[model samples]
Target chain A: MNITLAQARQVVAGALAAGRAASYKPLTVVVLDSGGHVVAVEREDGASTKRFEIAHAKAHGAVALGLGSRALMARAEQQPYFIAAVTQTVGALVPVPGGVLVRDADGGLLGAVGVTGDTSDHDELAALAGIEAAGLVGQPD
Target chain B: MNITLAQARQVVAGALAAGRAASYKPLTVVVLDSGGHVVAVEREDGASTKRFEIAHAKAHGAVALGLGSRALMARAEQQPYFIAAVTQTVGALVPVPGGVLVRDADGGLLGAVGVTGDTSDHDELAALAGIEAAGLVGQPD
Candidate 1:
């Protein structure tokens, strides 16, 4: 269930190409290893300076929690206390949109990828394309 | 080194509860499993829809890379191409603030969580609370 840096790089490259094909604005992307370690990272031109932070935060959340950011949103609605405690304990977590989990063909977690720049949905699409290019599977909602 | 769904739920609940005590605005919280999969999620009332996406992306990036979103942000400043490529690959990834990694007492990989709505600092505080509530250690950048 380990992920190679080369594979992560390929995934990011594929995703970037897809974003370009869709005429998306500048963006930032990141990949993390199975141990929740950074394998590769990139930021597009014209992306907001803060986007780097945003992208990392979202990606970090996915790998740390092993779930999409959207799912977290639903939980927050039901319980505010738990969410607050988590925020206080984990300084890096941001429960927003635009992050996805990365898994291997055998359903093993290889890592995760996150994108920022355009809408969350658009970002998810670009990530999906990148995962597909890498011959991997993106978790379905 | 696998995080269970039950653990993820506990972390989210704890964090949200902490936020409410502080009377913070609405928030979005997310938790990821050890394999970087979605385990649990929640969004507080008044939180923008985008918060959910941003929070998850940030957390995903943090755990995937084994670094805090803050560090990832700094790296992005130095490496734009890499970041851009990452955004292209992972649609849900955003390298912003508010993501954290969840680790067990033995420093084993547990999971990650992300929160949004308030300031990045506040969001992080909530995430920390969640991790602690789950009886796990939240990596401090």
Candidate 2:
């Protein structure tokens, strides 16, 4: 399944909203389709220039491996070699939290959402909230 | 040693033939010379968009490291950090089973082949088959 640009934009908005509510730092969010192609991305004011890459990579890795970044983080710890090789294979992969897989009600993969700027846990919370705002499911593990 | 244009074409043909014979998914093939320059590439219909980059990286890594991707996979298991560092330095390396180095009769390096679309084992099989069709030896270990 593919994520519509409108939905991606909504996800971004929701993430930003959640960030603001939590008084988190400036955030960057990236949404990518199942093919790992970016659909929408945004960097809030004060976010570093590298935030985009970091966000995109987190989302890209989630879609590329069909697993959330949180799961990847666990795998990275248990099997560092496999995760490292996969990071190279996928071109960009950050084995950390904040990269969540977006799914439909049927559990079908739609896309991925990546959030950066705040702590990894906060980023992940924002991403999940965003996915919820889009009426979608967020799989962080 | 150099792999001639004709030989490269032959390799592509053989790889495609093998894929078709096995009724595998649409495939992408990349042939690279010893210097890691692309000599030939083909993407079958319905292949995913990222197949080219994935295939190229596999082949490029094989030739760049002077070892088949399968061997790289093993090395990655033993030395995760080292492999990750090398991947970063090389800029493109996928330590997977689809990359195979091509060699001449006297064990002189000719080039490398990368295949994607099916399982990694199947991809490597196609690459080896292609090398053989070109009358070259395949070093996949």
Candidate 3:
């Protein structure tokens, strides 16, 4: 199922709020629809200049692969060269821990959310929190 | 000036509606901030898979240079080497007719809008309509 535009904004809002509430470093968040196209993106005022691109790359990686970046990392351990090849050739993804897939109740992917500008674990925490706040299921790594 | 997420979405909504009202081909629209980062993008159902990238490239080109793609095209005629250098080095822009800059009433640059999946003229028309609908100005090329 495709994610609505409203849902995409909600994910950004949720993720950013989580970052703020936790007093994490400033962040940038991105939401992508099922087709791996960006739906929405936002960068906090204090976020690093590179935050948005990193967030976008993470979200793209998640949606393009139909799996969370965490899962991809595990897979990458088994095939590092393949992951490297995909990133180098396509320039479409950055398999990392900050990307999370959003799914419908039936486990059908709706899209993905990505967070950047913090530790990988913190970024993942924010993304997962956003998914839950939006009442969407986030698949476990 | 900056384009708010709400304004970005309104532009997409307006452009897509204009496409439908005119019975144009399915389209994909993208909005980018002055920083050349995407604010939002949407591909209408039935749009070609390639439309999103085209739209994004168009928008990126517009904002990066602070000129509409039409203007860029004209400049490209005189400076093909410059355009080639930019494409090869940055890999972020596609200077072409469907991209337009968005501005505030004071002519402050906000960002840009790009549309794809139709003739370039039609794509530009839709982008202008969207800019007007969002209460912003579109700098005509």
Give the best candidate by lDDT: 2
lDDT score for candidate 1 against the true structure: 0.78
Candidate 2 structure quality by residue, lDDT tens digits, A26-122: 9999999988889999999999889999999889888766678998899788667656766666678898999999989998788899999999999
Ranking by lDDT: 2, 3, 1
Candidate 1 per-residue lDDT over residues B101-133, each given as its tens digit: 888888887778888888888888888888888
**Order by DockQ, highest first:** 3, 2, 1
**True-structure lDDT of candidate 3:** 0.82
Residue lDDT tens for model 3, A1-141: 777766776787798889989999978888778877766666665465567678878888887777888888887899999999888876767677999989988988888888888898899999998888888988636
* Number of colliding residue pairs in each model: 146, 0, 0
lDDT of 2 by residue, B34-106 (tens): 8899999999975655678788888988999999999988888888677789988986777778999999999
Local distance difference test, each candidate? 0.78, 0.89, 0.82
Poorest lDDT segment (10 consecutive residues) of candidate 2 chain B? B45-54
Best by TM-score: 3
- DockQ metric, candidate 2: 0.26
Which ranges in model 2 have alpha carbons more than 4 Å from their true place?
Answer: A1-5, A15-27, A33-39, A42-52, A63-79, A82-91, A100-111, A117-141, B16-26, B44-49, B88-91, B117-119, B133-135
Model 1: which docking level applies?
A: incorrect
DockQ-derived CAPRI band for the predicted complex in model 2 = acceptable
User: Which residue runs of candidate 1 sit more than 4 Å off their true CA positions?
Assistant: A1-141
Candidate 3 clashing pairs, residues 3+ apart or interchain = none
